[model samples]
Target: MQNTVTIGKQAEQYAYQLLLQQGLQIIEQNWYCRQGEIDLIAQTNDTLIFIEVRYRTRSDYGNGAESVHYHKRRKIISCARYYIHTHPAVEKCMIRFDVFSMSRDSAGEFSSHWIQDAFQT
Candidate 1:
């Protein structure tokens, strides 16, 4: 696989592990719908989380979190709605969105930021 794709996968895996360590139970990963894709979907107590995982080797153009543009957010919201409509088991759960941004230094040591409740609409 290309390095960029590998990096994205690794970053998402890292995000999933991090959330798990933070006491979030993994409900799913790489969830997709016609509207969009959610990198990680998890549940913590009463909240069902839809996470967007972004990573950049360097913040040249912008930080990883900054890459979640308006169009992307709209798609995510649409997908989340579709997921809820299909998964009645999660219908009553509180839905929340999160974003995890990862950046690596020259030696490839990652610096991560977990933004809880990153956005709402």
Candidate 2:
């Protein structure tokens, strides 16, 4: 069985491909700072997106996106602020928070849902 970290990495990779297919340019992955980690950073023509990737194998409680509660959103927002403070190049762009959620079906296939502007700073 794969560990949680391994599963998360796979989910992020899958989310990465999905974003690429949608023509979003990937700026960074697993970006880390003292605030926290942002799973993926991508750019659109006029927007800089900070993405949070979540994965779940069971829907016992809720789906992946639903798990990004208030505290998590706060952390992601704080981290995004730190990111902007450090990366001046993207400072002028519109900032958006996104969630790339993944889940495994009983057949073991993964399905993804991308929620743009999932939250805000």
**What range of 10 consecutive residues in model 1 has the weakest lDDT sum?**
103-112
- State candidate 2's TM-score: 0.96
For model 1, the local distance difference test gives 0.88
Candidate-wise lDDT, in order: 0.88, 0.92
Best by TM-score: 2
lDDT score, candidate 1, position 81:
92
lDDT of 1 by residue, 2-55 (tens): 489898888888888888899999888998878879898899888899999999
Query: How does candidate 2 score on lDDT?
Result: 0.92
The backbone clash count of each candidate, in order, is: 0, 0
User: Per-residue lDDT for 62 in model 2?
Assistant: 93
Cα-based TM-score, every candidate: 0.94, 0.96
